[model samples]
Target: MTATPTPSRPVWRTALLGSVAFVALLWVLEVVDQTTGSALDAEVFANGITPRDTDGLVGILLAPLLHGGFGHLAGNTVPLLVLGFLLLLSGVPRALAVTAVVWLTAGAGVWLVGAPGVHLGASVLVFGWLAFLLVRGVFARNLGQVALGLVLLVVYGGVLWGVLPGDPGVSWEGHLFGALGGIGAAAVLARPR
Candidate 1:
């Protein structure tokens, strides 16, 4: 007798699950940080990225998982879920690769040129995903993706101003570099193999 094949899940389901899991992680980390009296930002973990400091390098991996407060995390949640779900629609492996590029680029840029203070938040990834979604269609010459990108631009274009040095408390460097990373990823990943 022939065995039945298990049906694969839809890409949308996978994307939704991945997006929710990622957002949940951010919330859980924030809760732990707050409950521990902000110990994550304190001497114990010191999880924020500090410019040009050797000890602060660990933040490149952990900083995106943290935030200043619940308010901060909330501000990032919607954008993250939206952009992350769209990105993951391309498949998890590709999305992960794009994310790695943006993550490293944003963290390193902050470490190299950020102001003299600890930087922590998911904004870097948000900006990265934003830029990635905005230009990836153009890079791939996919009309559907191009249309989606245009729609996203209409919705999130105002935030692009964040790449500049406007807010003293905002890490514009992270935004700029995350965007750059996204562009670079699109050029590399969306190219014809």
Candidate 2:
């Protein structure tokens, strides 16, 4: 008997498109420089987003894709790639959908509980991805994966402290909400069948 060939991925094009679009969007935002403050200021969720109101909806999410500099965007690009790849491996459309829900959920929660100011950066994106990955490891009973997640958590986890407000020039609020977004994404994405 001949073995059946698996089907090609349907949404690979969309992921490619998203990656390109994300890079382009970063370039455009950098040139626009509408944060009305230092490049660093763009790190804030509200001010970083420009026009600043978020219209009370997509703002939760739209903020992460809007980065301040090449460095800031580069920071997020890898996670997007890594996490996006993982999401696609598990299931792309569902992964994207889960990410969207998590992003919005985390963003909104951050806005509500975070400090009263603008936030704009992919920090939340990073955290969300991390949470999702960590959760997956936990659920899969994969020792190596769990170890990797723990290492990531330990090395970068200190960054979480930056989310606190006491630190100067740090968007602790962004960090806080970003974490919430991540945990929320993990929960939703990992929900049982």
Candidate 3:
């Protein structure tokens, strides 16, 4: 008798698993940073984005993966899981493309005009994914997506103000540019193809 092949996981399940794994990685990195008495923080910031500083260019790649502390990481955890899973639900490749756009935009913007400090956190991606989810539907002209966007707007809209400069320590530049990247991604990816 021929063996029956197992069915592949549903897209939602796959997206969920991927989101969880990514969050787990962030947690692990945070643990390492904490255990080392924030030595990793120093190292990461040493190389982290310093506006207009050429030596800090590498931080554009490293910033999203580094957080100030558990408090900082925790603030981003839920948003990352929710937004990331939603983004990935479309497909890993598409999600990756969106993420890449947001990552580069946020990082480059911060590197160009951010305050004079070492900035690092996943909040940039959080803001990016939030914007992408909120606007992609409008661009795609999909009612279902529009409805979903409405729901997310109700739930996450308050955070949108983060794009503005507020706290002295906050990286609002990252948040603002990340949202821009999300909008740009939605414009490009949601086009009829």
Candidate 4:
């Protein structure tokens, strides 16, 4: 008997969720940055603001949902669309799981490796998704799809460099860590049974 292919989750739902959540997140980020001052700077979270000294643990995770400005948010919009679509295509639960890992992993990594002072952004999410898709395409051995993935990579992969330190206030650590998180996702979730 032929092995039945697994069914995928509804992309519509995932898209809707991505749309609503990220949009709200952007708006919230705008408000917080303006009112409380731009917490996007990685330094806010990177410092030793321990619960006793300071409390910004929340910022590391929440920063992605916020943007520094319209240009920043606009830059991420397309990537988010692609990632949301890919997750729906890959498997909603699995995609969500991967994203979560990337989020947590990237945040922690940034905290550990990021410069003493910098701001956070969605770069990690973008990095992780890029890594996840690249890994998935290779593992799947789907030539046509992988070819398309390569093209996409060529266009977007350049941004991954921005994640690295030395670019002023940009949080390279988040990018590196987030990329690792994405890679880990592919390693575990993308594994063939």
lDDT of each: 0.90, 0.61, 0.91, 0.68
| Model 1 residue 123 distance off true place after TM-score fit, in angstroms | 0.6
| Location of the lowest summed lDDT over 10 successive residues in candidate 1 | 39-48
TM-score of each: 0.96, 0.66, 0.95, 0.75
Model 2 C-alpha lDDT per residue in residues 109-186, reported as the tens digit of each score: 666665555556766766666666666566556676678778777755666666567855445666666566666665
How would you encode candidate 3's per-residue C-alpha lDDT over 1-193 as one tens digit per residue? 9999999999999999999999999999999999988877676556467788997798998889989889999999999999999999999999999999999999999999999988889899999998999999889988888899999999999999999999899999999999999999999997655
Candidate 1, position 131, lDDT: 90
- Give one digit per residue, the lDDT tens place, for model 4 in 22-110: 65677666666667656544344443212221254675566576566667777777787776566556666887798899988887666
Give the runs in model 4 whose Cα sits over 4 Å from its true position. Answer: 1-13, 16-21, 31-54
Error of 3 at 171 (Å): 0.4
Task: List candidate 3 stretches off by more than 4 Å.
Answer: 1-4, 44-47
Least accurate 10 contiguous residues by lDDT in model 4: 45-54
Number of backbone collisions per candidate, in order? Answer: 0, 12, 0, 7
RMSD of each: 1.1, 5.7, 1.4, 6.2
- Candidate 2 C-alpha RMSD relative to the actual structure: 5.7
Writing each residue's lDDT as its tens digit, candidate 1 over 1-193 gives: 9999999999999999999999998898789889999987775567689889998898888788889899989999999999999999999999999999999999999999988888889899989888998998888889999999999999998999999999888889988988898888898887655
